[model samples]
Target: MYESFFGLAREPFSVAPDPRFLYLSKQHRDALGYLNYGLRRAGGFVLLTGEIGAGKTTVWRAFLEQLPPRLDVAYVVNPKMSVQALLKRLCESLQVELPADADRPGAEADLIDALHGHLLLAHAQGRRTLVVVDEAQALALPVLEQLRLLTNLVTNEDKLVQVLLIGQPELRQLLEHPEMAPVAQRIVARFHLQTLSRDETEAYLVHRLTVAGLTGPLPFEDEAIRRIHRLCRGTPRRINVLCDRAMTLAAERGQLRVDRALVDQAASQVFDLPGLRRVGPGQAARWVAGGAAAVLAVFALTRLLPPWQTAGATVAAASTPSTASAPSSPSAPVSAVPASALAATAVPPSPSAGKHVASAASPASPPPVTASAAPLPHGLQPYDSQAEAGDTLASQVFGQHLPESEAWTRLARRWNPAFTPTADPCAELPRQGLRCHSSQGGLGPVRLLDRPGWLLLTGPDGRSTRVLLEGLQGDQARLSLANGRTLTVPLLKIAPWWQGEFHTLWRSPPAYAGDGVLAADGASGTWLAQQLARLDGGPAQDGAEGLALRIRAFQMAQGLRPDGLPGPLTLMRLNHATGVSEPTLAGSAAAR
Candidate 1:
């Protein structure tokens, strides 16, 4: 209903894990890194653990996206089956057939043989096989042991079959049990996925909007984003739920934008805030106190006092009492006040004052004046959430400063002068390397990515650095450095950037204006110019430089070499970026 009012193509905030709406936060990156590490390691286990609704499944999907073609993957999403059933499922996922009506023992033997054969085949093909069990906590102890035994299928130098166990926090406890010691010890990488931060939450909202084809300011106010982060506590799933509800509410109310009020309303209805009742004891007390005060004031004015009085003397005291007054019959009407005046008096001051007093008098009281009623703990903003955690783990991973955007821009400029200022320059440094940006764009949408066990660090060059997958936490991930340091990344930053083959067709030369700018053709260029004109500052001296930057960004975004040159792939990206029709290029000529 409100789409037209909001100028939206679709609801910007939906809880569904639409791969199109995934936002990879820092925690997600770490989770992906863990998955990657587990898959790459030789014949060892990897564990990923996270809280409920932390986007473990989404992270798993993202990891699948980045899988090398040679790696054979078996994903087990359900873990409630018996050991034999679990084995059968795994085999089925791997396309290994079992004999019909095979008994449990027979099935196990056949499954093992098939697995062994597949592993050998994979080895011959220079590939590795990985078995990922999601919701591993649901697996029985015997089933877990059976899984461990599968790891026994190995070459003399390394185990051929890799296992990944992903589950909630209970899985961690399960692995630590005495009976599961062997399995726990076999884990080579582990990571725990965490929630997004406040800033990340904002980016997450915008990201969803952009992915949904929005090309303007997001529909949510900053305060609304903050409330969402607080209410969701950085959990991707919770954020999605709350945001979806908020959008629905906004649409229902025929509002064009989502604000703090809408988010608070949505969060209150969705997430069960145990101690956050809408009209709790504090509110009740205030209402009661105000009512009592009003009553007391009325009693003092109407019942006890005369219409006029001197300093300590009543009006009647100044005049002698007239015996003729017949003792001023007590039952007689003594005074008359206009009913309008009384009604006016009955209305109390705005509730705002009472709320302020309550908040100031008691620090524990929720601040009513806050943008939203949701409470966000420290260290939970989107950008800070991941970057801070990465920084914590950086010393252990790279032991140095990460590179900055300026460095990457300088490098791109030097490598390809045509890489004009318009290109979005990015660099992937070695282990502990950082990608620098001249001007960092605001946070994008929140989505999940498949990057396993990825960490962000600063290189010795004073830039950022990243440590990919060293630890696992259930099907989610926890970041860790080689030195045993651990950190959590948000889910938004870990989500994969949206791009495909057509991504390159949208590529355009850099335009020196602002981030996310693209110009594929005359129409797109006109649109870009129009959008630039609407900006507070006019377009840069060379809009081409900005276009170049976007192209660079497109290159990095598309997993290209980040050379800042507009090849066929670059052109495709430009087409995608500008939402223009892709132009056909002959053979490899356009690519060059």
Candidate 2:
């Protein structure tokens, strides 16, 4: 309706998946890169997940528009079907002709044979076949198992079919089901597409408007756009819904531009709120009035969202009664609710006790992974009943609480199998082709470093305890304790107690000795120069050419101090950037 008045070719804020309007924000770009990389591989699954309106479907469509010229795609838009129905749909999507007898509902074997034959023919003709599933979280276990079975249809040098699964964050959780292990193991690439940032939110509007043929300045004022970001938390679809309404309101009022007041007015109408505050997805409209204090507490406590190693799918959670008590072991159910749904943190007293934390990520919980090993020492559980009173696992005073040696050993095992429990684990690293790295920072930098590490969580008293942060996804953290027990907890509860100290292990580069300063004329320096060149897209050098300056520049960019030394942490980051083969968090390890 406002297109003519705004001088636009089309509606700028339609909630549709159009490739032209795909804004290449850093997260989007990261996801797109993984999609492109997944397509290049011969076989395996490419899993992409996000919130309902987080632009996952849009990214998948963009991937389609950029499909390899020689690809045969079997796209399943809705995967909530029986295993037989799923197989039939894949056949229909890929144009694989079904036999007359295959019309029977129970002819799954025949359906599989037909699909295998079609894939083989396609492969022989030098074509790649890919199966793409949307809303994959709705898929049944047998359906998922069938998808894994499809991956087994292979010849030498390549599998006959490659699959891409796109769904909400729970799809990530669903894959973690122990029964889904076969399919989980085949995921070659996985990325949790997150919402845009504040800057990207603004740019998203500009890009959409520009694509819709706007030649004039933006219709929404700066304050208006910022307000929209706060309300929508940078979710693209929510941005579209709000902006569409705001523009329509402006157009009706015969105004050329929108302001903060106009945006708030639009939000009130679109979200139907008397006062429009930060409207998180899945949050109730009632929260706009009663949730302010709780929102502030949780927002300020703003827990560490690990680099989407979100359960690195298990990073998800839900609500419970005051009587909820956690199981003594990881094997038993923590609650009727999954671990992802349960907030491990103390709920700061709220005006309405019925409300949950607004900032808490609401990924659907999958079945908790059952640990066959021993439980937390003395039956200490992951979710404590006293957590609401600030007595979480980290805050507990257990008689058999893990000592530093065991913590160091658990941390060491990620890198070195032979690593033993010791007070000085750093001294044991050199002999294991590894190096010890420590740093103090918030979760963002540690996530940027993106290596699993040991977190020193202190209790109410002055004493500290060691916990292994093996997986981090959104707001859920999978922590390993001394007895080899693992459990997922909300980062919200843990963030307040942390004072920013951590230690991780990194593999040193070739010809690099575990020693003091890396000499400029030494082999290590030459290797560092080449790695830097790979990242900087510059020339590789055997001789020093402003090598110290290059190292310092790299350090500063990576949030490290501007020291020229090539420390183990810096090198590990370089390895990550250059796509070196190394162990990642559990969430990303399988995909890598």
Of the candidates shown, which would achieve the greatest lDDT relative to the real structure?
A: 2
TM-score each candidate: 0.52, 0.50
lDDT (0 to 1) per candidate = 0.54, 0.70
Tens-digit lDDT track of model 1 for 473-556: 211234443443444443233332211110011223444222343343455554444433332123533366554444443344
Error of 1 at 212 (Å): 2.0
Clashing pairs in 2: 172-313, 309-312, 310-473, 311-315, 312-587, 316-340, 317-340, 317-341, 318-341, 318-342
- What lDDT does candidate 2 reach at residue 42? 61
* Model 1 stretches astray by more than 4 angstroms: 1-5, 104-106, 274-592
Q: Model 2, which residues run further than 4 Å from truth?
A: 277-592
lDDT computed for candidate 2: 0.70
